[model samples]
Target: MKNIYELVTMFHDVHPFVPSLSQFAECVVAYIGVFVIKSVFKHLVCLECLESLYSYLTDIRNYSLIARKSNDGLLFPAKDVI
Candidate 1:
């Protein structure tokens, strides 16, 4: 969570946006809720649970990169048709 806070701080600092710690906490809590709920049902082992989270984060990073690169501002290109 400290890492997340630092990353959020750095992102807002670089982008010159207002930083809302409450909103950040809310988002983190929501993700934690989802993780807990999924884990409860899935019975994932520790390593598998971390891998699932890592994969989801990686997908989010990739999506952001794709959105940043696209002129039309769509997350997925029209040609990709996802």
Candidate 2:
């Protein structure tokens, strides 16, 4: 999970404006959702796993907000203004 998050973060940092990044993130979340659903049906998922997945999703959302803000220059003070 940490690795996946890190990879996504790196991708976002490199290509923040790419539309495919959003699609990639959505696909990852969807894949996780399917895994969770299958695990639940098979009685393989535990409470801790669910909590961890929730935490991951929250982190992704927060990171996305940070990325957006950075793109808008809100995360860093302006160095040059005309």
lDDT of 2 by residue, 7-41 (tens): 88887788446454575565444444544544554
User: What lDDT score goes with residue 74 in model 2?
Assistant: 26
- Superposed model 2: Cα runs more than 4 Å off: 1-21, 44-82
lDDT (Cα, tens digit) per residue for candidate 1, span 1-82: 4798898888777855766556446444444444454454366567654444422232343244443444742222121111
In model 1, the Cα lDDT at residue 50 comes to 40
